[model samples]
Target: MRSILIALPLLIAAPAWAQGDDSELWLTATGEVAVADKTSIELESINRFSDDSGGLYEIELAAGVKRSLGDGWYIGGGYVRVVNYSRGTVTRTEDRLRVQGGFSTDAGPFKLSGRLRLERRAASTGDEIGYRLRPNIKAALPLGKSDFRLFAAHESFLPLDDTDWGENAGHDRMRNSIGVSWKASKAISVEGGYLHQYRLPRNGRTSATDHALTFTLGVSL
Candidate 1:
């Protein structure tokens, strides 16, 4: 586990070592309130920055409920509101509905988890609807008897249905990240690390690569 944790950063950064890409930042804050031993209500907000990393160009607000189905399986459903700012103007707003299920297991000293999510997206301007699927996997290793954990994840977005105003059917985006999580207390934890995102072109546009710093704060109650 220790050796794997030490190698994760190098593995995550190797792909973009020679390529110059846009630098961005993302911060997400989340709070969870327990409804039962296996259920919780989740709330989160994500702020995204652009190349110069000056101000937020996008924001995502999300709320959801999740339940453990016994063993290492779980299910969840959620809603999201996305706001985008660009070119000195408010560009777009999106409403999203999502459903997800996943499973996790302990593998030696590491915990491995995988999830599949389906999303329906509606835009305010065009009103066109789009569907997408996101699949991701993560591995976590706890530093012995400590409050620190090392984790790495890779997530991919695949369009399911085409819409005039949204992503077309194909690969949409890929995000890979490696991070460390610190438990500040029983109810709070903080995570921050490097994330690499690759976006496929839409229509005739060029592909984009984003090298970003990802930060998150999680609170449990």
Candidate 2:
């Protein structure tokens, strides 16, 4: 398990390294609160810095609620506000609403999960309401009986329709991440990882790729 985890990033990153065009850093903080026996609320903040954008380029704040259906299945919905910055100035702002369903199950020593999400997005720079679909999958392995776990995840972004702002009607981008998470206590946890994002060329746009170092701090209550 350890050896596989160590090699996962290298193997996944080989093609990305050859095609990556930008470097970035991403930081995120999230909090979750149990509101009922099978329901919880979550809040997240994400900040992204990009070499091409000169500095901090994107910021996202999101709030969501999740309801467990028992038997490792769940449903969730969320609203997100995204702000794009360029050279310390705000360039565009977007509002997004998403609904998703997912399932998680234990497969031997590995914990596996997958989700399918649909999103409706409105941006300050565009008149059309963009629709998107996202499919994500993740796997995690516990490191002995310790407080740490190794994980890998992949997600694809598919635009359901063309938008004036930039979203084209087709396969958009995908993200692949490999990381380690440490549970600091019952209430707090931390994660760090490498993420590679590749955007497919569509509607005369050139393909682009970004390599990012990602970190997250999470809290639960």
Candidate 3:
């Protein structure tokens, strides 16, 4: 446990070791409500600010529902509306539909989880539908008996189908984050982290990297 805790800071700082093209901030508010036994609904709002994109570059609003399948397994799906802005002007909008399933389990003092997501994305700038696959894993460890926990997560974006609006059918990008979560109360938690995003070079495009400070406020009811 001590070794793992020591490595968490390295994982968080690894992105900064690379040459990042942009600096950004991401803020998210998420809430979950139990509607039935073993079933819940989640709603999220995310706002992102970017330096190169002229600040306040993106906004996402999403809602989803999940049903626990017993013994640490679950399935869910949701819709997201994404709006892109440049220099405070709205540039494009996107609609995304997602279906996902995953599992979670505890290993000694560590909690591990993984999920796979399938997405269908449609953009206002193009008629071609884009299909994407995202797989992610996360691990968390409690800070002794305190209400704070340390966590690290990685997610990959793979484009399954090509589209005119810059979707190249291949490995697209990845996100890595390291952070700590605080249980502020029984129903509220807060998380703050450093997130690194790297986009693979494809279709004559140069690779891009983003360093972001991320914060999240989560509520459960």
Model 3 misplaced regions, further than 4 Å: 1-19
lDDT of each: 0.86, 0.91, 0.91
Q: Enumerate residue pairs that collide in model 3.
A: none
Write model 3 residue lDDT over 1-221, tens digit each, in one string: 64454456657666574567898989999999999999999899999999898889999999999999999999999999999999989999999999999999999999999999999999999999999999999999999998888999999999998888878898899999888888889999988778889998888989998998888999999
Q: After superposition, how far is residue 52 of candidate 2 from its true place, in Å?
A: 0.8
Q: Candidate 3 — worst ten consecutive residues by lDDT sum? A: 1-10
Residues 89-128, model 2: lDDT tens digits:
9999999999999999999999999999999999999899
Which one wins on TM-score? 3
Q: In candidate 3, residue 125 scores what lDDT? A: 90
lDDT (Cα) of model 2? 0.91
* Arranged by TM-score, best first: 3, 2, 1
- Indicate the residue-level lDDT of 55 in model 2: 98
